[model samples]
Target: MGNKSSSQPPMKWPQMPWTDRLLLSLVTRLRDVTCHHNGTVNRRLFPFLDHCTAANPNPVEGVCTSDITIDSSCNLYVRVFMPSDPSIQGRPIPVIVYFHGGGFSFFSSSSPPYDALCRRISREICAVVVSVDYRLAPEHKYPAAYDDGINVLRFLDSDRLGSIETVTDLQLDFGNCFLAGDSAGGNIVHHVARRWAASTRDWKKVQLAGAILLQPFFGGEERTESDIRLDGAPIISMERADWAWKSFLPEGANRNHEAAHVFDSIKAGIEEAFPPALVVVGGFDPLHDWQLRYYEALKEKGKEVRLVEYPDAIHAFYLFPKHNDNTKLMEEMKGFVQANRSI
Candidate 1:
């Protein structure tokens, strides 16, 4: 260790199992041929890859789930997870608005992994979870996903939840609502929170209390130390990251665009009203430097932001239950929510 005060731990790259490797490789190839080349998702193959989960109106693990449309025209919706735990039934609980990570070009709120993750969050934290099924890129492209992310909040703010007995009766604490996401979803969380902050409104409900960004996908044209060292990262290799940016960012735009490089070049995005944040970073993630830059940039602007560094963990480590870091992450998130509960 460099110093007793340093939070940094020993560096260790996670060993990828052959099964995970095979799945990742297959998914990447499918996105290239079906989504990119064909200008639309392969109707037959993409669903197989997504392995989408359906909402169960009845309780599962003491949590009830249902799907609600945010925008039917664009196929935008949210899978709502409400804890049916008897003790917490009639009381207000923190609400977490979640965005899933797939480089912004893949995955959905209903993706099996995300469904499980959101359910765990709802049941463990005893909070309502709304996983946004934002439109994918290379088809919808830049700003489309961002717009959809914000729209979810707008939908919630409209008090539509009050109309649905399942959601309305849950008594979600709108004042304690939080934004949380990983990878590209993390990127969406940041942008959506910023947009919410910049708005001037006194809506009946829906106040952004805090944000949790896990390995937020942000980059620039210039390479950093982590970028060079983890070029061949286990899952989120630099090549895959580059491809993601190409698909999400506007055509002809480089990684230096404001959306891709939030911490630098355009410091204006960090608004004073932006909610307190907890940003998680993995040592083995190539985006490590970028995530750190975001934390520092927030500090420089006098914003409330905390950084959690898992030196031995790899990118997207929070998704898997086996990773020790994932358990730690959930603990940190729970503490953050309890501490940041807006009085």
Candidate 2:
């Protein structure tokens, strides 16, 4: 945790319109009902949520969908979204392999927010968006999800494989690739980035444009003041986060493992030849301070980095298109991608 300042404003949710408030209440009710009966959500929720997203369409153009299988058994599925028109000609378009957030235990590729956001990013950034549906916890734990993430990238960058089910066949500009994720997915992106950095030969063939982390969860045993303050906030509570973390890690595995927390172990290596990074955090999120620390560490290494903090936002604010701040964040992301197009 970073040093606290008394001058920092207290974290709290800002006022919302009645309609938005009602929708949030309904979502909470539905989430509680589903969790109560099923214990946790299954992959089926993805298609259903996709339908919801399709109904409430956003201002995105060119939406193409396909699945990629990381493992041969076809158990693991990775969904992808590509722009209708080729955004980059003569070269493979820059690709963003996105990992969806659900504490690494909940949600699927079909979640409304995930589907809509993936489509929006594809259209907004004009890059192919690959959403990895890595195996979840209790049944499959740490390193499993991480391994699947690495394999997915390997498969996409492969030139030999004729075709693979569950994985897409889109031509990718492997040289200009970016790893991105939210929440637990953010943790996966960070892990993959470290691995990519270490495996220079493999990653060198492909340019790692940068990493975009949205409310990443870099875990540690000790709780920061922000975590203590936002212990029971709506959307993502501390208790839920704790449960998710425990569920993701294997039995008796230290939560602070280099592969688990990442920042501590890979900080030095990350500082050396790391790709540029953009980290976005909600001002009211418990992980805000941690994101700031990560940003500072990258800057200390003289790495190109950008940080955006939304003052009136909470965790997962970017997933909610209804929020004005969320819309602005999308625009900012588009500009960031445009300006940072890998050379």
Candidate 3:
């Protein structure tokens, strides 16, 4: 196990303002009531609430859907959001491959929260957004998701896969690519980045501009004090996370294996060859120190890295539209992607 400090303070969810509290209460009630009879809460509830909270009505236009198969049997469904105006100034628009967060066991690209966020990013950043629907776990195991991710990128870069398409009917330059994801999705991005760097095939030459990790889980074999303190934290608890990880891995597989835990596989090739990355974490999140450690690792390798910590936020806080912090985070993300587009 990695270093564990019992002296660290217990983690807590950030306090919400009255308005936000009321809104959250309403959402909780709706979710509870729906799940009471339905047996499961629909993941779309949160995104639907987000859409309602936003003053703008679907600012994104001309969204398209497609599927790219990673293997002969398994197919990955992808949802793409293109800028309303596809007329680029003869330059290739940057592309963001977004992976949805669901502990790698739940959710899909069709989920409302992912769909809305992808659309918003595509419009706001003036870039192409590709929301990947990789295979889920327990049914599929560790490295399965990672393999699917790498294959998706390969498919996009290959003409044989026929996965590439113009955004908003305008020519797209595949040269600029960004990888972004939340939770388990973040884990996928990290592993994919490492694999891409180590791959020897010509297909591995695709240029990656940057990567964005939102509350990523990077710890392997050890739990930080924050994880212990937030053992029963709302939404995502340490117990829940452990279960998710176990289910996502093959039966009897070691959790500490490099293929299972991204941080364990740290090597010179990964540290030096990875593109600049931005890691966003909530101060109250159990994974706070985990993300910080990842940032430190990147910096030690002399790679351009940025870390943004929201002092008064929680895991998945960015998905809530009613929170002002969410908007601020989005703005920062937009700026980062725009500034790094040329890289």
Candidate 4:
């Protein structure tokens, strides 16, 4: 959290509509009162917001979950969600290595929004969903989260997770693995898939079936029309997005770095080496243009891609379990995984 100085000008930006101004003002006041500045953000700043970390009863029926350490060296952990559906009762099931989003500086696998979302996805998709709690940035920095992602996949491809009794109960078919996430997590999904596709070391023994990116987080040196048009969009504003990039990237790195701008990696011509992808973008979100551009780029590269757009939705809407659009989003993801299972 940044310092809120009493002598500073009004926090509200110019040209903000009255309603938006009211909301942003309230949120800013809350942050000013509850959050404190440190070298890196400690998201547990607000007592009211601590619910995101507290233990909660599972919100989805017929699904079981457990937390396990993925890499002891880095203290990286993942929450494994498994379904009790009769169809996959005694057989190996598809695996989804899911990453949660908080602009790479907030949120965790145990957060309520992610807990409910992953649980629902496990039941709907009938697959083992490993929700990763990768290291956050302004501390761990760029490649740290990426390395944690690769390590989690490698753990899945091996028999290490099965050492836990609960995980052993649900057979995970690594051969049918898929990677997924929303926002920053979606960006990590892209990087993880690309690295695996381009690697020669064969670090992961299982085949990557596909990737599902829900409103992927992306930025560049130049602004797209949507970025300009939706400068102060709800949930993610241009300033907030810029802060995320600055906080997560290496100190001297610019937005054009391959890590910040995914198109650079795509243009490197790894299309034939990549797996099929499903991209979901919200129509009202600021990142909409970049999401669409990436989708078109994938199609132009001749890679199999499926894009689902919600023109009226807000960014990260699917993270809310009670949101009417969330179920539909989860269904679309399940269908995509099943449709591409043979790949």
Candidate 1 lDDT over 1-343, as tens digits, reads 0122246554455666566556556655655655543334454677666677889988888778888888899999989988887887667788899999988877788877788889988888778899999998877888998899888888888856664445536777888889999999999998888889888375558888899999999998888888877765666766677878887888889998888988763366466778999999999898999999989998888889999999877787766656767788888889999899976
Clashes of 2: 8
Pairs with backbone N, CA or C atoms under 3 Å apart (clashes), candidate 1: none
lDDT tens readout by residue for model 4, 144-201: 9899998888776676756543553866677788999999999999999988887735
lDDT of 2 by residue, 174-258 (tens): 6777888998888888788777777767643455778888988776776777787775566666566666667777677665766
Please name the candidate that would achieve the greatest lDDT relative to the true structure. Answer: 1
Tell how far residue 197 is off in model 1, in angstroms: 0.5
Candidate 3 lDDT, 1-343, residue by residue in tens: 2333668665456777776566445533543433323123454565544343221223335444444344567876566666656456466788888888877766677665667677767766777777888987666888788888888788777765344563235456566788999988888888888777666355633678789988886655677777766655555656566666676776676557665455545544464567778999887777787788888877776778899988877777766667668777778788888888774
Instruction: Indicate whether candidate 3 or candidate 4 has the larger TM-score.
Output: 4
Cα-based TM-score, every candidate = 0.89, 0.83, 0.80, 0.85
Q: Kindly give the number of clashing pairs for every candidate.
A: 0, 8, 0, 0
Candidate 4 positional error at 150, Å? 0.2
Q: Where does model 2 exceed 4 Å of error?
A: 1-12, 18-61, 86-91, 160-171, 203-205
Best-to-worst order by TM-score is 1, 4, 2, 3
lDDT score of residue 224 within candidate 2: 73
Candidate 1 Cα misplacement greater than 4 A, ranges: 1-12, 15-43
Q: List the candidates ranked by lDDT, beginning with the highest.
A: 1, 4, 2, 3
Q: How far out, in Å, is residue 300 in model 1?
A: 0.6
